[model samples]
Target: MAGNTEPLSPRAKLAVTAGKAAAAVSRAAGRGSGSVIGGRVALKLDPDLLARVAAHLDVVLVSATNGKTTTTRLIAEALRAAGPVVSNALGANMPAGITSALAGGSDARYGVIEVDEKYLAGVARDVDPKAIALLNLSRDQLDRAAETRMLAEKWREGLAGSKALIVANCDDPLIAWAASSSANVVWVAAGQEWKDDAWSCPSCGGVLQRRDDDWGCGDCGFRRPTPQWALSGDYVLDPHGAAWPIRLQLPGRANKSNATMSAAVAAAFGVAPQIGLERMWDVTAVAGRYDVVSFDNRDLRLLLAKNPAGWLETFSLIDPAPAPVVLSVNARGADGTDTSWLWDVDYTRLTGHPLFVVGDRKLDLAVRLEVAGQSFRVCENLDEAVAAAPAGRIEVIANYTAFQDLRRRVGN
Candidate 1:
C-alpha cells in the first residue's frame, strides 16, 4: 500500500521501487499479490522469484499500442482451451505489474502477458515467453510514448532474438513491417474490414493506395502481407441484424480484430482456432477498457481512452442512434497524467452527441466537449455523473488513472 502509481515521469523511479517491494512480499507469500490502493505498499520484486516460476510454464508476451489487453486476454483464454493458462489479466504490462501477475499466477501452466511497447524489452528478458502476439501500433500517449515509429524500433530490437512463436497483426503497416523482421512469424491480416491504412508504405516508404483488401505503396510496392488467416467476408446490416451475434463480446471493429488475433495465436500453439476462441465465453472487462457494470441500480460503462487512437476507437463503438449518451473523463491520478495527449486524439470523430461529462478534470473535458461543440452536462463526481445520467445505458470514457479510482469509489 506504500507504492506510487504515478505516470512514467519524475515519479517513475518511485513507482519502480514501490513495485519492487510489493513484489518481494508477494513472492515471499507465494500467492497472487493483491491490489494495493493506498500509498503504503512497496513493490521491489525478487529476480529469483521469476526464475523459479518461469521453469513451469510457457509464457506468451503480447504487445501493442491499442489492443494489447483485449488481444492478449482473448489469446490467454484461447490457450486455456488447450490446457491450463496463466496471464497478466489486469492490464499490468509493466515490469512490476507483470511481476505481480506472475506472482499471482504461480500455479498457471502458461502465461499471456500484455506487455507495453516501452516495457516489452524488460519483460521479454524477465519472462522469456514461449510465444508472443504483437497486436498493432498506433499513435497514443504522446506524453508517455513518444511516437509509434520510435516504439516500433524499440520493440523490434527487444524482440530481435526472442525465441517465442510470434503471432502478429499484419494489418497495420508498422506492425506488418515488424513481423517481417521477426524470426518466426505467423501473420493475421485485417484486410478490408479495418479503416485508415492510407499512409506511407511499410516497405519502401511510398504512399499507399487502398484497393479493397489490400493497401499498397504505388512507388515501392510495400503492401499488407498475405496473412495465414483472415476474417474478411460479407455483412448484412439489416436494421434488425444481431449486434451481439459474435461469440466474442467486446464491441467495435477493434474488438473483432482482438478476438480473431487471439484465435490465430491459438492456432500457432497447435490448437483448433475455433475451439480455442470459444473458450473465451465473455470479454474480460475488469476495470476500465469497456468494463460494464451496475452502480446504484444503473448500468455504468467505463472505458480507458488514453490517446487519439483509443478515443477514436471508443467513439466508433458507440451507437450513434442510441438513447442519447453520457461521457465522463478525468486526469486526477494516472488518468490525466499528461492531459496534453488530448490534442493528439481525433475528437472530431466523436460527432455522436454526448449527454454529459464528469470527473475532477471535467472542466478540461468540458472545454474540449464545448470546443468540439458537443453537448455536455458537468458533474463533480462519478456518483453525481451516474445520478445525472439519463434513465438508460450510460457511457463513460475515463482514462488510465480515473478508471481505477472510479472503480473503487463506485464499488466496481
Candidate 2:
C-alpha cells in the first residue's frame, strides 16, 4: 500500500526539507543539482498539494521535450514584466526542486515553474497551477521510462491537473490530443514546416496526416484542429529576414517558438500580448542553455549541448566541415550513465568534419564518431583537447557531465 505522508505546506515543507537537501548538495561537490539526491523523493505519496499551493499564489507550469527550460525562463521574464513573479531560477523542475525554487523566490503575484514529463502529475498536484503551456513532445530519456506517447497517456489519466487554462501547441499531436481531450484549452500552434514530421498514430503505429501545420492520424482518424492563436509569420534572418521588423536576441526557429510561447501564456494571464512580446524583444543570453560565449578574439563560439536533441539542433547552426571542432562527451551522475541515445543522434553528418574528441568515455564517443567515417583526436580529458584544437573556427560540444571540465579547460 502507498504510504500516506501528510504533505507539508509549501513554505514549511521546503523550509524543513531543503535545509539538508540543499546543504547536502552544496557540500557534496559545491554544485547544485548534483548534491541534492532526490531519487527517493520522486516516489512516495503526497496529497493534493496543488490546491494548497495555489491558495498561496497563481502558478504557471511549463513542460516539453526539447525547449522547456529556456522557454520557462522566457515565460517568467514576460510575467515579471506584467507584475512581480517568482520562479525556479535554478532549472529544477521536479517536486523537490520546484519546492526549493518556490521556497527560495520572493512571494510575488505570479509563479512560473518548468517541470519534467515524468514528474508532472505529482508536481501538478503539489503546485496547482492556474495555467499550463504544453509544448511539443518528442522522443527523449528513453532509458529512464516509456515513449512520448506513453507519457502523453499518463497526462491523459488526469495527472492531478489544475485544468486551469491550457495553452496547447497544436502542431504536436500528443500535446494537441492531451489538451483537446479536456475543456477550456486555448490552442497556440506554429505555422507550416514546423510540423513537417509529426508523430504517427500512437495506437495503430501508422503515419499521421497533416492539413497544413495542423495534423491527425488518418488511419486512426484522430485530428487536432489548428490553433487559433497562431504566431503565423515572422522576419527570419537572412538576405530575406523574417517579415516582422523586430530584432531577436535568441536566433533560430526554436528560440522564436520559446519566445512566442511565453508571450501566449502572458496573454492568457491578462498581460497585454504586446507588452509580453516587447519584453521578449529585449531578451539577451542566459548562462548555459544555447549561450554564446566567445574566446580567442571571437574565433570560436562555445555552445553547451547537454542532450541529444540539443546537439542535433546546435550542429545545424554550425558548419561541422573543413573547420576543426571538439566534441566533449562524458558520464556523470549529473548527465546520467545512459548515453544510449547517442545512437539515436545523426552522427553521420558530423563524420566529414575535422574533429578532436575528449571526455571520461573518450573511447566510446570516439568509436561513435569514427563509425560515421569521421577522424578524431582522442584525449584523456578536456584540457588536452582544448590545447590541441586547430587554430580556426572551432566549436566545443560539451555534454552536461563534461561541461565542468570544459569550463575549466576552455575558460570561455
Candidate 3:
C-alpha cells in the first residue's frame, strides 16, 4: 500500500500514482532502485509534498557524518513499540528519499528519518521533527559537502528557532557546536571512536586537546559538555547514575553507542530506555550493514565502509583468520566521485590479511593496498572472487553503491 490515503485531493492522488509508476518503470529498466525515482517524480509534481505529509506525524530525525542509516534504523525499530513507524530503511536519505518515505507511509503516526549531513537543516526546518538526534560529524564526501565546519554552522543556524528537543552527542566537538543553538538539548556521551575529523575547535579555530576520555579546546574555553546520558562498559548510564546493560545483535562499540543515542531519543518521546535498548537488540542488520550472506557457497559478512571513519571501524570487525577479505569500491554517484579519500584510511591495519579487490575502482584500491605494504589480488567478478576465497566465512567490505549491488547479488 502507498502511505495514508485519507486526505488527498484528486490532483495529489494522480501525482502519487504517476510517481509510483515512474518508480516502477525505473526499476523495470534497471535505471534506479528503491523510492529514489518515485520520490523525485512525486516531489517534482508537488514540490511541497513532504512538508504536507510530515505535518501530521511525530517525527524523530537522525543525522551524522557516518552511522546515519544504522542509527535511523535503530531508532525506528525502537519506536515501533509505540506504533507503526515510517522510515527510509534502504539508506536513501536525501530530500527525494524522505519525500517518498513520508508519502508512501503516510498512515503511520510516527516517522524516523535518516538525513544526509548536508541536507539535515532544511529537512528539519520543513518537517518540524519532535526530536533531533545529532550524532558525531566527520569528513565525508569532501568533493560535494565542502567543509565539516560549514555544515555545522548551517545546523546551528537551522535549529536556532526550532522548538524540537535536541538529543546531541557531547563527545563530538562539531556536533556539540552544531546543537548548541537549540533551546532544549539532551546531551549523550555516545563515544566518539574517530577523532581525526574533529582535531580543531569549530568555535575559535583552536587546537582541541584530548584529556583521558573527553576533548577540550583550552584556547577557546570550549570543553566537552557533561552528558545527561552516557555509555559505560556495556551499559547506558542515566542522569541518576543508574546503569542499564545494552545487548544488541549488531557488533562493535559503534553500534553500542548508536544504541545509547537511540535510547536517549526514545526517552525524549516518553518511551522507556529499556524498551528502546531491548528493541534495538533485535536489529541484526541495517541495509546491508553487518549482514552475513551466502554467495557461491561462501559466507560473506558484508560491511559498508563509505569513508575513512567507517573504514576504520569496519576494519576492526574483520576476523583475522586466513579467510579472504573482499573489498569492493565504486566511484558512482552515491560512493562519491572522488576516490582520493581511500588513501586517508589506515589500510595498514589490514596488513597480514589476504585481500581481493573488486569493483569499478578496484585498481585504485589495489594501489592503495600495495602502498600500505599489503598484498592483494585483483578479481572483477564478485561471485568468482567469493568462490575462490579459501574460507568458510569471508568478509566483504564495500562502499555505498557497491555494497547495494553485492547485497542483491548475494540474494538479500
Best by the TM-score measure: 3
Model 1 C-alpha lDDT versus the unseen true structure: 0.64
Instruction: Give the alpha-carbon lDDT of every model.
Output: 0.64, 0.64, 0.86
Give the winner by lDDT. 3
Clashing pairs in 2: 25-35, 50-125, 50-128, 234-242, 234-243, 235-242, 235-243, 236-241, 236-242
lDDT of 3 at 14: 70
Over 28-58, each residue of candidate 2 has an lDDT whose tens digit, in order, gives: 7755453124322322222333333334567
Mark the regions of model 3 whose C-alpha exceeds 4 Å error after superposition: 1-6, 30-34
* Global lDDT of model 2: 0.64
Candidate 3 residue pairs in clash (backbone atoms < 3 Å): 3-104, 4-107
The TM-score obtained by model 3 is 0.95
How well is each residue in 74-167 modelled by candidate 3, as lDDT tens digits?
A: 8998899898899988877899888888878766878899998888889988888899999988877767885889889999999889888999
Candidate 1 vs candidate 3: the TM-score winner is 3
C-alpha positional error of residue 111 in candidate 2 after TM-score superposition, expressed in Å: 0.9
